[model samples]
Target chain A: MATQRILDFLATRRPDGPCLVLDLDVVRDNYNAFEKALPNSKIYYAVKANPAPEILRLLAQLGSCFDTASVAEVEMAMNAGATPHRISYGNTIKKERDIARAYELGIRLFAVDCVEEVEKIARVAPGAQVFCRVLTDGEGAEWPLSRKFGCVPAMAVDVLRHAKALGLDAYGVSFHVGSQQTDLVAWDRALADAKAVFSALAQEGITLRMVNMGGGFPTRYLKDVPTAQAYGQAIFDALSKHFGNCIPETIIEPGRGMVGNAGVIKSEVVLISRKADNDNVRWVYLDIGKFGGLAETMDEAIRYPIVTPRDGDAAEPCVLAGPTCDSADVLYEKAPYPLPLSLTIGDEVLIEGTGAYTTTYSAVAFNGFEPLRSYVI
Target chain B: MATQRILDFLATRRPDGPCLVLDLDVVRDNYNAFEKALPNSKIYYAVKANPAPEILRLLAQLGSCFDTASVAEVEMAMNAGATPHRISYGNTIKKERDIARAYELGIRLFAVDCVEEVEKIARVAPGAQVFCRVLTDGEGAEWPLSRKFGCVPAMAVDVLRHAKALGLDAYGVSFHVGSQQTDLVAWDRALADAKAVFSALAQEGITLRMVNMGGGFPTRYLKDVPTAQAYGQAIFDALSKHFGNCIPETIIEPGRGMVGNAGVIKSEVVLISRKADNDNVRWVYLDIGKFGGLAETMDEAIRYPIVTPRDGDAAEPCVLAGPTCDSADVLYEKAPYPLPLSLTIGDEVLIEGTGAYTTTYSAVAFNGFEPLRSYVI
Candidate 1:
């Protein structure tokens, strides 16, 4: 559906109902931008972001590889027609069964952080190509993966050398810059770190065949965040220049950066009340709460765009909250929106940029709310 | 299962894997305490807190009313042998289908907050006993429900009059003191407000039959928070003094206060890493992340008790986190635990008080982690 048609269909629904309306036009545009930025590198649409089968199918049809974190995500991608060779199980925590399933399904590329994980993977699937995830010393990223999953530079070399000695193909080096990363320089630093690891592995007589720059490209939540294309280009350029002729096949996993902007939660304003102390301060409550797609608001303190469906003369600032009985169900504090000419009890509010973790990591049935319906344009 | 048996069972499983172990002994004890505290009042086990069917059955066996917020919860309670009169459909955001389902299933008591809701309930089940949810101006509660679903005090009276005028039995006044409420005085103040409303309704020739003091009793989180029994007795005493012989049948909805301490999440310590600059400060990452029961850690900035199964020697403080790739998945910061004489790669750590919203709310399939398995004692 076109954006206008999707909005119109949603507007016709009960104004005080909770629903997730996905805009495929913007999703395609985002995909194309990533493809354009890193022309040589393969873009793996991270299924962990928005794993709706329809969205996955669309990305698969667009010739994008899938970055699956779990067996379920890999199954979802495969069900969506993604080829096995195009699926990379990029999570560090590998249970023996999950590794066996991934290997049996022809998922060749696996991300390994610890020696125990690599050993487990080797036991399960000896032929699997593994990427030794290296921890960058670089700080000041939004969500550094080094704290939990990645091995240090010295440890990475040791792990890779051990993997090669054990007859497992240590195929690549992977590092996550971080989630919602604002600084593009972080990727350049991460790539430099990757190159150093690559050189170290070469001295240990291991041939690395892939350079996986794990997903953390910034999505536009607020205006100040850089575009995904600009972020992708910086990493692509750094990898190309650093490795020169020795560069392996490049892979970029774009999770939230791709889908976050393509979806909006269209909910009806169920209740509106003015604060007794400050009459000017209004709290507009929607039918969806923190249990719905708005769980991101609780996690990241992100306030998405709260907009009116129809154009209005002037926008007034108001607090937007979910209908659940929790005080923490707030979506935005004093968000500005176009005021309706004559506001009624059941006005509609669009919470935009909710495609990523909204449905994928939601608790829909807590207050007996239904799971959101997904559609493709 | 008894607490000891559950712990033993957890100790035997992938004693090194992440899992939630619910202590049925503590749960039953808490249920008995609530029954004793609210001797004259009907105790509704708010199923939203911990929606395990076994728990519902146990509560029902203990002669507790089931406070249902959705059709599924109602069905769960009804399947557990809770009668229609023992169930209260308390959620304000009632979809037409849900209301109709409740009516068909013989659910009698309905909590209405707005004019639309009143009309919706009347149209669906005209014979249902309706309660006008009055918004209280009580302060210092953790989660004030007035902001979401309650009608203003005056509007509540109007709603009652309107319902009566429409030939609907608007039988009571209800208000929530809020969740995680520390101040016991807030209950007294809210009850005082309820008494004034009851008197006003009586003067208008309306004999209100029920006065619901909605759930917000403190759980065993912090040292300062009161126990469920203490909070329940405080409310009961306040209501008894204020209403005397004119007191209606009281109702209490206790969600987290009942199930909060009834369960513990048993997880294996997957990785222990120290910051590069600070070797003394260590972070222990468990198999469970925010996608599991540790979600509350991010929301409330509160940590649960992290204990080892084996009785060890001296205790040491360390940061605990989940196994997911997200950095915000930390369960506790600087949490003290006994350092085992021989702590190795796969030591077990049990996180207590995760029974409420842990399993039901935070089971997102990230990184192929297995969903929690529940075993009743």
Candidate 2:
């Protein structure tokens, strides 16, 4: 939802071309909600979601730790007033040079999914705390993570043992239920895998002390999703069920959930017409597309709520597309999106729930369109 | 195939991180080949494929016209020394203001697929030469363009008629067989559709003079494709078979065919490990992935040939991935790519046949990695 503040900003600035307007006020509130919901778990704000300097500064001021994917993000968080201890290099895939660079920056926390990555960290970032990510089924996630990442739980035991052997702190286990995850039980299943890794490691004389529950928290898109409070309750129950009274230190990395609903992309209807007069479905072309942003619309997943000025009028399903010359630029066609029947050319529409995963996914001058411009106020 | 010049440049420059290195000599040769193949048709280099200023300058100096997708691209073409007459606003979807801007910039040619787009051109870019794009089956293309672009040939006739009535030049009919089209007969089918539009319009006393054979040229990837001579002969035969020697003014927009094989991307293998000891497939993580610049690997459509220093060693199938934290960043998984068993971390690999459609598709720092840096020699 576009906050009144964001709407007001758009009304006043009247920015040219398609751009993303993010509300810091909304981001601040979302951060507070997550903190309240997960009172015991530390919140590592996923920096890849949206690394706008203002958002990073606001999160730093609010005492949120950062989950970074690369050395650049680690530098961004540090530049935004976060100390090295407050940041975790969360990407399981990393170059040895990049690992060394982060280590030189005084960051000790790292993520790994294989013995090879653990060996690199041992050679470079000695004695760093490392967490092995366990694989998840990724059920109920709109943007399901594939097996490209995490190793299986059984492999996790071996990876952690290797980390301990290399003189690094075998931190804990991590798993992602997948991005835009909706089912509450998704966390319960992943937690069971994490607990198994913990038990196997403990029996081998290495006690893991943390469980980095990777980001999967949902953001409201076309439908209402579970609130932060609801997710927090579900996660806490899962932790208790798995660990009993010995709940280790926990961390929740919320990327989309933190800022997804906090921004709106204001775009114009570039064109609207039927393939033929007899064609019942209309094709609605917008200034923004997959390359411009809204890449989550790939595979018709993560359908964002579109707001048209003619909202109250009768609506019909229209095949939505982007302004790029590439055929892959079509955003919604398999499942036509319903828009007002009276929608015409040059009409402005706001794509909501776009704060997260919008700016970063934007291409650099694809088809001569500049990267998605963002204004954080 | 990387020419000796590109390989020599890469060997000498040794640029850090994944970057594209292009050879201008190859593009020049490609342009000459197209000219010899379709001697009667004007060559309009599709600017969206790879808008590198060096490539554009070479094409412009060689008297190549440009098919641009936006006002910015039109300006890029003009800045690269191409005159306004040599540029076509080839995107069917455009903002009315953008149309006015291009018109103000002295662009007199445009592309449209519907009456609504024509109406915009009528209001802002009056009397401009407008070509209506007709739908094609896109049958023999690896990247089959969907119905996102163009309309049925019958609707194209109406679109051109509407353009003529609106004081615009009903100049031509255009159809793209689809990108990376390997079948030489694909153009024959699409030309049949263009001929239908031309015949129908000629019956209504509108003498359309041009047949814009839109880009569908394939670049060699993993598999060898037909030569430019083969395509030209087939297209010429189709024209003779349809128009009976009274050929209309013709244009061929070559995007990929012009530069796809002229460039190569130099990437490093970041890490390599199996999910489990028993797991047969190695997960080979590269410094680049779908978001980084290999976006064509979505659905494993465009498989670029990988050149490893250890190419002669025993080979095994590997699940290739990018360095990003996003799980969707995996390049090839459905059909794993075979790589040298001796390939190791930090070894540089060359992704060949990637001169075009690489830089523009790159995300702007998806995980703090910069866009695919390109060096034209």
Candidate 3:
């Protein structure tokens, strides 16, 4: 749920423009809930999802390990009071300079999928605790992860062995089931793949112990996703089934699930005119769109639950768009949303489950729109 | 064609990261050429296309008015030494505050599609020169832009009437044939639509004066486009055919066509590894991707002419991707681009015709990566 009381409170106070509201209290509760469910698992919060300073500060205070994809994220983790030991450079495709800089900033843990990246890490951060990201089919996921990352299981074993030869810590394997992954079986399948890689590395006499299950845990959006407890149980079952209950020091990187529900975006409806007299598609133009903060609306891959203030009025299917002059700034064009017919100019359109990818994906200066602003309570 | 000598010079000088290089001299040439072709048409350079200070400054020096989409763009135009009277607030969806601010900053002309925006503008910018943006089919464009703007021609007349009633200048009719429109027939069709609106508005005694044929002029990309002179001739012939010799004062908003060819992005080939032994698809990772600067590759909409070092080797079809850890960051996963098999890490990939919409569309902190850097030569 969006916690209507908080949203109502926020709308009354802030009226300048579109902004994301983040609640640290909700963050703390979500963190504790995840921690309680998976007691043995280390929570490495992915910084790329929502790297708000206050959010990172709260997570850092919660003894959260950081999963950083870039040098700036590593530095952000450190600046948020996380020691280098708590930050893992999880990006496989990184420049050698970024790798070296992360190492200089005291980050020792890195993730790599290829032989070349392993060599770069070895050259930059020798003896770094590096893990091989193994490939999975990314089946039954909304945002499929089969492309753009990971190596095949057979190649992953060699990458790990090569890591050991290059004076690097050949830590365990990692895999992602893609972002907002709907299917629970995907985790089990990925865990099994991780186990296969682990077994292959063990056969080579290279004892790897760290298993980083990369971020895929879905957050509550337009649809009700499987809860954190369900994910936790599935993860636990997968770990037990794969490792025979002798689980490695398991790491779960939760980016969206940790902060997604805790935030809401408040945007005003700029125009709510039907595109044409005969046209049924009412174009509801909002101040924010793809270039503003809703980049995940690409093909409607991630649907943020939207709510208007005028709820009692009859609803009509409306195509929503952002304020930018670009034709591509439309949010929901194909899918005509049933918005309240009473919703008009200046009416609040609160977007829920928008914390994670919203703020970080905005195109700065796109059509002269300011960067997406976020406020924490 | 790209100035290869300048590109070679840039690659030799800048080896730090991916950069979009803007040639101000080229911008000046393109501007002069367009003005020479369409001597009577007022050129309002769309600031959203590039918004580089140097580029804006050069255009401003060449006596170009700016078509501003947002408050920041209006301010950018002002900062570039453009008078407020010279800046037309072209974005239909805008905050009331932004309208007031623009009015306060002395912006007189504004674009509107619906009644709500017209009313809002009348309230904030009373007696402002308001243009009615009438809708068209937006046909035959490379990047089709039917959604997010304009109203029916019938609604446009009412909108203009309403604007006049509210003490505003009901100025004109505008229709975009979308960006990078391939067919010249789209313009003729849109011009006919504008003529209809013009006749309708003239009968209503609104006397709309400007025919704002919104931007659709294509720039050179991977494929060759019709010359600007060809577009100017078509536009002139269309105006003569519709409005006759006594046509109203015209305004053309050229965003991409004006600045796109003046820029090129030089990005380093980060990594290239065969995805699988049997799979012929090689994954070529670049320092820049969709989020970094190439957001137009959403569905491979904008194909830049990519040139790499070590040409003439055996060509292999490779899938290009950005450096982000996100799996969705694959740039050309579906479109397997043929590149030199000898291409390796740190090799330069010079992307031509990337000047417009490149630097302005970058996500600021996407995965902790730096914003797309742009250098003006």
Assess each prediction's global lDDT (C-alpha) against the native.
Answer: 0.72, 0.93, 0.86
Interface RMSD of each: 4.0, 0.9, 1.3
Cα deviation of B2, candidate 1, in Å = 6.1
In model 1, what is the error at residue A8, expressed in angstroms? 7.7
> What shift in Å separates residue A37 of candidate 2 from its native position after superposition?
1.0
**Chain B TM-score (each prediction, in order):** 0.88, 0.99, 0.97
lDDT score of model 3?
0.86
Q: Which stretch of 10 consecutive residues in model 3 chain B shows the poorest summed lDDT?
A: B1-10
TM-score of chain A of each: 0.89, 0.99, 0.97
* DockQ scores of the candidates: 0.34, 0.86, 0.75
lDDT of 1 by residue, B1-377 (tens): 12677767765664445666777777798888877777788888888887787888888888999888888888989999899989999877666667899999999888886666777778888867888776665466654444655766767777777777777887888888777678888888877767776788789898788888888775665456776667767877887788886778888888878887787777776655544323455566677877665666654345566566554664456666676656556666635333553444467666676777667566445444554545555
The prediction achieving the highest DockQ against the true structure is 2
- What 10-residue stretch in candidate 2 chain A is worst by lDDT? A272-281
For candidate 1, the docking band is acceptable
lDDT of 2 by residue, B1-377 (tens): 97899889888988999999999999999999999999999999999999999999999999999999999999999999999999999999999999999999999999999998999999999899999998888998999999888898899999999999989999999889999999888888888888888899889999999999988889999888999999999999999988887789999999999999999999999999988778999999999999988999988999999999998999999999999999888889889999999999999999999998889989997878889999999
Q: For the second chain of model 3, what is the TM-score against the true structure's chain B?
A: 0.97
Best by TM-score: 2
Candidate 2 lDDT, A226-257, residue by residue in tens: 98999999999999999999999999999999
After superposition, the stretches of candidate 2 with alpha carbons farther than 4 Å from their true spots are none
